[model samples]
Target: MKKLLLFLLTCLLAIHLAFPQPPAIRYQVAEPRLADSLDISHYAKKRGLRAGAMVFGLNMGVWTFDRFILKGDYAYINMHTIKENIKHGFVWDNDAFETNMFMHPYHGNLYYNSARSNGYNYWQSGLFALGGSLMWEVFMENEHPSANDVIATPIGGMALGEVTYRVSDLILDDRKGGWSRFGLEFAAFVVSPMRGLTRIINGDAWKRRSTSGKQFGVPNVSVDISMGIRTLELKDEILDQGMGIATEIKVAYGDRFDTEETKPYDYFSINANLNFQASQPVLGQLNIIGRLSARNLVDKPKHYLSLGLYQHFDYYDSDTISVSSAKTPYKFCTPASFGGGFIYQYKGLKNWDINAFAHLNAILLGGSLSDYYKVDKRIYNLASGYSTKMGADFIFKKEVFAISARYDVYHMFTWKGYSGEIDWRKIEPKTLNAQGDRSRAILHAVGLRADIRLRNRLYLTGTFMNYTRNTKYRYFSDVFSNSSEGRLMLTYKF
Candidate 1:
């Protein structure tokens, strides 16, 4: 249920970016800030105090629910608990991976959006996330402050919050009224509840006007949704998982090659794959890459090239599969990363188009399924390393037929682990502070995809991918595994 909600939240981040109103415009202006000539009547005046208050109120509301409704032990906080938490400082927490990795970030989004919707810029709003997380750790819970939560919450929140905030802004149109206006407002509300509440409180929800609500100039946008079947094979000798439902959503927000925007996420692309009963993770993978800065190298009639800095958020999760003798869950993620990359585009005779890119990033934080680390339902090792990715796409007759290839490789090194001399039976449970398996892992994937247009805005697509993982541990024998996956889907583009 939680995964489903998160998937929907991610979808909402792009739903409004696809609004088809203004014609696509290139970001010729190098400055990241919106031009002063753009209309500001739709947005409220900056209100820093109000934004702070809203963030605090949001935290209080969540604590109220956790304290009274669900009545969890952690919710039992008092003045004494606050002092204890302060004294303990910070420690690695044993909460479930989903809670630390996904939920905390979502909560921080509320904090960030509170400031963003009230007219705060991206960097300024990030402070709200950091402050809000600190308050939650020190005041809202009886447990000690978490080391991982502090790192993941604010950073992850800023990335995700900006995406949703941008989408909501595009959805809000003060020019329309009646049911149309109500629907637009509702959709924006769904995307960012804090922003929606601010709108209602500020009386912008029903206020009609002649000016469009867009703050930033609209850029070219493409949204693709696909649905079909997927198959997965865990091991070469094991039987493949039977066919199951698979759906994908991809959104490209701007003309990357043409954009001169220096702001983060101004030119970005996000892709999400969801599987249902396909012997795969319900939320299989979510990959996001947002441009931070870019410089065009060559811009000719038939050839274009650019180099850019990007921020990345990648996630992969799967349940444990026990087939005969195999019993291992699949998980790998890099929630925060930054990198540099180059993009090349070529237009040729006979209506042919080709695009390619290669990127290398330093992973600030990463996670992988662990073989030896298991503390209170946590079995994933946290590490920091780097990754390299490259891909290319070919389009013929303006998308009548298309094919793409991609390759990704990741190298991670875990920093926290127990000594080999320690006996498993003698080790105390939950006593160690994130003493995970000391190891280094290398994971890689190669994929191929083909699409055939059946008609306008519709296509049939097929994909095949192979994944491999190799891990070397200090205390145990090395582990190696690989999997193969295939998918066939019908897609619609908007």
Candidate 2:
């Protein structure tokens, strides 16, 4: 049954890529001006050819690495595996979720950069991404190609790629020279290596003008650096407590409520978070939300509905301390997800704004370590889930002060994996039982934030978050855990 659903999804995605919707009439008001200034027809064809060549070159490079460096049989090109994959069609893979869901999309974003840097629009760039992923799957490896990878790669790649492209633009200053130009270009490369390489190859790395042209709206970027203490408890017993330094950077592009023909990612948000601590100093996450389409409600100028896609990458590793035995069990999880959802926003009320969103996503692949009873067990699970978030903010004194609160809940169903046993020594010797049982889990998070304007483009911020997770298995004691964190930080925006 699951296989059938996966195959259907693959077919749908292929069709969507092969025959995209007609390009919307974007920037029509400026078309005449652009046409007079530049040769649009000739440039468009040249860009397309360059983008295709880049994609082909990238695929060949990956194939070389897999065949020569990895030397794994699965990485070799085998006609037998290719034939089998074609006959059997799409199937769920045995690889961990992180690799399929997270890493594949990361590679696909590089493919996306090839098209984006050559002047393709967002939708067209996504199609190129899809084409690149398909070529790699069909020709790059000996193992059977996966349906999940095809679905996750292009969609998730476009989401992550757009954000990378925008952030790289912020880091680059083509008008500078000497060390400043070199430094800026290097930093942009760090954010988006593929785009930077393309720039260098095209002799635009030190051009005196921006290549992408002006964006639709003013872009806002902010950074928050904070040091704080966090406390975690399980079953009413203190597990671990520590002080940590965390940093978050946010980029918001355009306004969602703008009354104009919206382009893909016309209104987007990207956030990156990093935490430094003893147990897991490299705890990292990248979240991206891009608007696909939106429309204003009839007779309500301030109310709008939007459809968007999101890509989330999370890596968490920590130590758990047992209160009684003092034994420490290590826990780690690397889960990545790609999904789409609907967003509703209201700004009709004076000095008040409300926003709500709901999304359903598939956990295409993931890996985790479970320690339900202090016995560390490695596990892998694939699941489906939904999440909802709602928030409201009050503005006062003309943007000088603001208070906001948000609540979020996520639920996931793990039907194929096992939950950790309370006592591993007492479990029966059945094969199914040894693998673990199915489970369901819910995560609840609530946060409140207040910002006081200290000066223009600067603010003092205080934020608090309470998070809880509850897991229930068909045959095990339900486990509940919670944590609280608070921070005071100074934020600067540009």
Candidate 3:
């Protein structure tokens, strides 16, 4: 495993160093016919294959990295600067320095000869820029945030501004910052690290490098309290933009774990989970998500349209829980999942936003260190339920400190990759008592998220989530299972 990880990181580095193209390398893009002897088909095939690999690797890594990066740069602005500076300014940002000649963000494509050289419609450039900027947030975690939800991350909160500009171009019929562009940009940002990790970590295996200690909640308020200590080590930077170096060994500790008792325990159990992302132009977006949930532990969800870069709501993002009595030995620790999908956001609205993204949660292989981790049968088929969510994110910012909120309804989708109900009991026909197992899951959820500033670095956030499921099966005996869980959280920026 260690060797594979090391190799992947190295390959990611090479791809980013070579291709470095942005705007999702439009498949529709007509590559000007080269006068040289190189076959365009061969070149395209190789590029696409490598791009897909790197995209997958970085996405998997970000699946775990995105969780801890919620500490917005604004969190620092509130801490280092005076309350009045923040109060008067309202919004916190490291605006373009005097040296910024291009109208783009710092990490944006500055090459005058690149595809963007011709200039982009709003949605085209907007998505890529926002996606890149958000990816930069990975290394900027100075505090803590939620582990399960990506939008809860500070990077997510602030990315709204960048995404806004991208969205504006679309509603106006300007494809400049279109969703496609945002997706491509996000991919560029992602590939940089995965490739670099290949050059950084000396081993081929992946591990959950740390745990979480942050505790936060806000049950009765417009916004839940988001508070914790999230951390990541800068490991590598293979991208020319000086952004792919992740030398810090991405790690986290003390990310709290919580369970919603309203129904059967619905929560994430964080056991110091860790993962990596390759940042090559073609390799950077690939991600590898690690162990269970609860803390802003695993990486946060990535943006829409950027497939292969693990998403905030990826299907396999969580550990699989069993409904049988035999007790799968791996239940205590969080389960790790591997899957991929994409996100697409619509433009044409000021604060009214809509996003559509999907992912597949393959199989959950979760367990503790000592008792689990066997060779061969190491993975448990918690394929009980799969989740798909559709929602809209709205933004309302007017100098008083930007405010944004998103609400999503998650549908529990099962049958695909489902292991069926755990019938721990095997009965004989002569026993006169046979009970086959059955399972049914509603897998529906409603989530609401918000962020506000009482002043400066002193910010507040709230999140409310509810998940419910009902399962029933028949045999010699009838079995019915129903569970509902809700999490309310609050945080105060230091």
Question: What is candidate 3's lDDT per residue for 288-326, written digit by digit as tens?
Answer: 122222222223233224333221212111221222222
Q: Each model's C-alpha lDDT? A: 0.75, 0.56, 0.25
Off by over 4 Å in 3: 1-225, 228-342, 350-381, 399-440, 476-494
* Shift of residue 262 alpha carbon in model 2, Å: 1.2
Clashing pairs in 2: 97-365, 97-366, 418-436, 418-437
Say which candidate scores most in TM-score. 1
**Displacement of the residue 256 alpha carbon in candidate 3, Å:** 26
| Candidate 3 structure, TM-score to reference | 0.28
Candidate 1 residue runs with Cα over 4 Å from true position: 1-38, 41-44, 234-241, 278-280, 348-350, 423-430
lDDT of model 3, residue 343: 41
- Lowest lDDT 10-residue stretch of candidate 2: 16-25
* Tens digit per residue, CA lDDT, model 1, 190-304: 9999999998999989988666667774656667787886655523333334447888877777677775666777877777788896455577877778888899889998889
CA displacement after TM-score superposition, residue 241 of candidate 2 (Å): 5.1
Question: What TM-score does structure 2 among the candidates reach?
Answer: 0.70
